[model samples]
Target chain A: MADRREPLHLIKSRRDSALATLVSGVPYLAWLGIRFDRRGDELTAILPYDEKLIGNPLLPAIHGGVTAAFLEVTAIIELAWAGLWEEMESGRIVPDAAVDSAMPRLPKTIDFTVDYLRSGLPRDAYARARIVRSGRRYASVQVEAWQDNRARLLAQATGHFLMPQG
Target chain B: MPQGPDLTDRDQTRIAQQFIEAIPHARALGMRVDALGEGTATISMPWAEHLVGDPRSGVVHGGVVSALMDTCCGAAVMSHPAGPASTATIDLRIDYMRAARQGQRITATAECYHMTRTVAFVRAIALDEDDGNPVAAATGAFTVEG
Candidate 1:
């Protein structure tokens, strides 16, 4: 999307934020057409539904796996987004080109569970993540996805990811 | 009472194959139905550029594997004897054991382990030819039409 294509150079000049760089550089997020809106410390993800995402044609609803992945990807990106700020504040890495070399941490999914509350219609979907705990070696996240109304969830998921040290 | 002839296993297989092929997302994913039996189904996906997650490693995305597994489960449910007239995914859980090697066709097989009036349970595993071990394991529950 026009808004999602903010390259690293533009981000550096505009926002100077590592999370912004990662959001643009990550190839998978772009492929899935996911965009994150940062509101203070909380993050909200948007998935503009497309015909490519429909699984069951009978009802023409979005694929359940895509919905599940959308939630999982949001949680991982949220961690990386928040972790960048944490690492920057802790001063473990210098705030120069070294920041580029020390990329934001990538989490390896250990296990994930998704509960489908309702069929995801062929329209925009929003997701938000809740971090249950983040430890030295792992992190737990709970995520919910909805369309139109946040209270009416299409799906809810929880995942445990191995925190790969940078 | 008038009765219609029961569908043979051969006919059921043909119907299942057709149903799997008709899924819009399955068509987009290029999923091929390899087999469909009484309680089991197998779907295979060839390596495609769009399916890659880590470009550096060239490993297939975890989500692709999940999609394959979920589709296979759905196909299994469709062909199972106790399968409902219609169904929707209720819940699914996936555990990744390892990544599939690059450029290898991944295959997933799923079985309907249990079925009640309102729900059916499924378990599945994904693997590629390069490795004997499974790439991922999953269990899912589907809501059945009563």
Candidate 2:
């Protein structure tokens, strides 16, 4: 299957547009201004700094809920991207046709746990999610968010989602 | 505003109201404190189209529920009898019982059930008209900033 796949750049561009469509489908993501950076199959969610995202003016810290929302968005998108890859590789859907069609329904979040390691500074934040386990009925994802220094995580979370069935 | 002292219910309400106003995101979401006590708070936000998660379902996003619960939990800690000046989230766990119905106001109530020298514990529930059925529930640990 790897031998029959499209060239690297072609696949990258296809995934990029597909990811954009998926991200745009959710209204809350747009409201939060959460966007993704796709590097091959890997994705990094970016939250641009906005003054309105502040929860505490005294601490000048970004809202904890905003951070959680960002992390959850990252996990959902990553899972969607992973699922899309299967159909894309099998030629079940063409890049041109896929972009025009409505995106598949997103998995529902069953539960989420977040750990705030440090206060989020008033600056841009980045997050990446790892699919701890993706099964037919359930998926677990772990996400880490960082600002400025990648080594220092501002917050981290784990979420379980109920996957949509066929 | 002394630490480890009982704050009157009226004082708690004032502190919670001021804290909610200071939060830009909470203000953006139109969240307001409905009730406050020694170590508890209840806040509400009216449904808005922009807050919808899935257009097809018209259900509010899980993250929206989380945000409401988180803010309420923090307010509970802030109004605690111990009076920890301020608090920040250390960790939080949220379980979504169901999607919130559209066009309904959502309210979250939280309590600072426990406090230590450096941390406070909180639990909260979010509801939309149906008090018996919660939209979501949360448990969290918060820092007791002196």
Candidate 3:
């Protein structure tokens, strides 16, 4: 139990650190008041509607890139929360810590499919993600973005995290 | 190859620089074309305080990466002598590999895998020089419109 708790604690600390880093490091997201909330296997983020995110000159909708970014971060953080970071740090196993020495080896996205469910209104929007499958060398996740109560976008992504070479 | 003047080294460099200059945010982000030739271009954006998402402490913004990917893909598409000068992204998918820490300059290498008269397919990976590993990877399809 203690051993399990240690890993969990380490993961929580890492997640906290990541959240802090995200909120502070990315200015445009901070400008939009994007915030993250986590619970067990699920992660969610909120982005306040802003005129700057608008793309279309007529309807003034949140840009698709904005939505995609929100989903991407949420999925990555969710994976981190699942102790994937710890698995990466145990260097005897996974060795590539390229992005950050602190971050563990994780898969790179090989493919992603996103669908625009509805036009994101000129108001605050929310996104949530859950791991659909986490295997030895791959993972799939589903994400959705919502404006108010309406589902505005849906996405599914598959990634191939390179396993340590023997 | 179709009959046309092949872009010289100077032509490619000028085209890349012009594309960078055209994007207001890219200019503000201090994006520069370090190299451009054939079907590839390497671009850089120096991290600045204003580019920070949280101004309280300087951390680069996520939107910066998105904008960078957008611009890099466009440049990559145009790097092809036959590709369009202007193109619209049909869809772009970016995977965040890691958080770019404070004061970390980011670099992107974009390449056009394939191109047709009306469409271009591009992919790129961005890294924080401080980390050396990819911070984001993106693939996009751009439609050239007359």
Candidate 4:
């Protein structure tokens, strides 16, 4: 049992640390107060409500651009996590050491489309990204964001990215 | 684009300024309205270290460009001859042509190309110092409310 638990423990800590490093690399993500929650290989991004994120004062809704930004961040980070999984599983990268150096170059955005279905209320928002197709040089991701209900999405986005060259 | 009654230049400036001031995100980014016509608007924001996406590249994030374009498009819709009192994005598509250079002001110009009873269509482009090259381009549909 102890033996069985060892690699799982390593995987969890390493994954968390690696993600932390990636999140910290982007100054804008920090400025927007975006954080990630990891469930094994899946990640859910969280954007806590802040007054500075409001775009329409009368509606008191979150800025459309902020919603797009959150979705894009989710897609990029999810893509990075997916690519980093193999290396982490194989122990190619040192556990919790030199994470910044081992950081995979983030994919660049090619294009992004966002659909605002509903006004984003002035509250915390959550998002998840699904990779539709990830190729050697390109990737497509779909993201959904919601404020209160997971079933009802406030916004959704589809983004294409150019993968970093090895 | 069909012509609607245009606001005076002074009225345009005042209204545009009030619109930007009411938006928290626009104020946070220090977005300024440079020009406003009957159905066109131009907005610009200066570079700041906090807005950088990649430290090594020192490039502003794509989101900043998106926000600028979105705001500019909405401003154009609001200034249209139809005179939408407010607007909300229905959908927006952004194409990032190139990474914006750091330490330069980025400007976006948007045109309300079409309008219907309740919908407005807009297109916008963002540029830095490079006169001909654009950092990003965007097209969007927004709800028109009076």
Candidate 5:
């Protein structure tokens, strides 16, 4: 059988580099082996199924947090691919950084609302994000999850990117 | 404030503090309680370095968004008179209208539209400081478990 596993690629750009450094320290996501694959305006990420992510052992449902996380990441990456990263770095956006950033001036997720369309089972899941709208100051993105060709729609998220003034 | 059997100030404070303590990520994300009453609760979080997918360019991650919504809903449920109830989300639908600007602190306001003995229905919207337009909208159902 052909290898179905997609190779992981290091995210380019200074912001992505910093994000990778910070995310590596997360114990839970690190354990899940989440990998990102970027291609033009689209991004595909995989979250390997792990026992820790299961909410109910008997029913074998993935935790809602895990699903939310997966969807959130997918949307962020998609926005990055769409070229909204520059504005976000400048800190001229809404849903301001005070709530989302760990460090001063670093724009992080100020707020995110994810809708869980379906339950992620005990199987590995995949997510894809598409940029719904992108502008100089703000951008919007959408994401969906799939398992074995069935649409799981783990979650959908919308983000705001602030641009710096000259 | 309209007089109703809403969550008391003490109860709201306790639940907010508990929620901040219970979820490590939520705490790490710097989630703050804005208000809790009338079957509704609002929370705020600063955009952090790790929360962004591209730190140099500055775009926050969507995973963090979902986490915020989940936390808000959970807190909203706990703010109810039942006192610290455990919940499992049955369905959460999110609609993204725009991307959150980097360095912006996003706020989430969640309202428990309907609550019964076994289930709670909630809807939340995340918006920037101006609060002019919503970045995302979500509605979900939570099963209250003992």
Candidate 6:
């Protein structure tokens, strides 16, 4: 119900932005167990290891598409969060009612590229995103996914997403 | 250098079926092998409530089509006469033409367009009811290694 939607008062930062919580509601994100967390300026995605995500029964690695989707989702979240951060920094006060109705700020992914650096073992994988440049029309983001060590990235992705209208 | 006489059609289908079976995520989305041809594969995914991107619109998510395209491309590589040992997606780019109709089974077909020793190139199209009109199209490269 509109009365029960997440309040926009939480838009102090990307971590608290309504988009962060609204992401969990997306069916694919919910079913894939993709969780978003904010570490300083970076938005990180945690993908729970599931047998259904496996691509090769031999290496037993998570499906490439799964990793790709993870990175893609991270980029969108990062962008939307950044947009909220910009609004907050601008000193515009968004009322609580408007926040509830405008919480789902998902951007459309225009193009995405995912490169497998190594085999993703069957374990929880973490991904972090960096928005290169964002404007009124589009945003470019880079994301990395790693297993045990951040230095040992299993995959990297660069993508462009269409931002919402002015 | 993984090369030999390719797996027979039956063998390829069995391997593809196993590939689909082993991937729990694929099964979760109701993915299945629909057909196979020389250097090409068609995969189908039934629409489920969980696959919807916009709850209000009830349209299938673009990522679902991306998954179908990627998995179908991998299958296309394995069916190649080059004898794909094991392959991983190197890079993929998809152009979403439109959202797929809800409650319809979407089918995707991928073809191995080119291959080298260590890499393979593929193109895929996803459609709902009209085979001529695609909801999305994708191009990507895959790691072809023994």
The most accurate candidate by lDDT is 4
TM-score of each: 0.86, 0.92, 0.55, 0.94, 0.55, 0.84
Q: Which stretches of candidate 2 lie over 4 Å from their true place?
A: A2-10, A94-102, B1-15
Which model is ahead, 1 or 5, in terms of lDDT? 1
lDDT scores for all predictions? 0.79, 0.87, 0.62, 0.89, 0.64, 0.77
**What is the TM-score of each candidate's chain B when compared with the real chain B?**
0.89, 0.91, 0.84, 0.92, 0.84, 0.90
In terms of docking quality, model 2 is high
Better of 3 and 5 by DockQ: 5
Ranking by TM-score: 4, 2, 1, 6, 3, 5
Ranked by DockQ, the better of candidates 3 and 6 is 6
Candidate 4: CAPRI quality band: high
What docking tier does model 6 reach?
Answer: medium
Estimate, for each residue in A1-166, the C-alpha lDDT of model 5 and write its tens digit: 2124423342234445434533443333454468765444345788888775654444657767678777666665455434444343443432223344432232234344555566667888898877666665655566778777744465555555443322
* Candidate structures ordered by DockQ, highest first: 4, 2, 1, 6, 5, 3
Q: How many residue pairs clash in each candidate at the backbone level?
A: 0, 0, 10, 0, 50, 2
DockQ of 6: 0.59
lDDT per residue (tens digit) for residues A22-87 in model 1: 666556567778888775557899999888788888788998878877888888877766676666
- lDDT per residue, candidate 1, B57-110, as tens digits? 677767778788888887777767764677788999999898888889999999
Q: Across residues A46-121, which tens digit of lDDT does each residue of candidate 3 receive? A: 7876666654334555555556556655655555446543443453233223344433333344345445456557
In model 3, what lDDT does residue B14 have? 69
Best by TM-score: 4
Q: Residues A94-164, candidate 6, lDDT per residue (tens digit)?
A: 42324455454567777777788888899999998988998878888889999999999998988888886
lDDT of 4 by residue, B16-132 (tens): 787798799999999999998878999999999999987778999888898999999998998888877778999999999999998999999999999998999999999999859
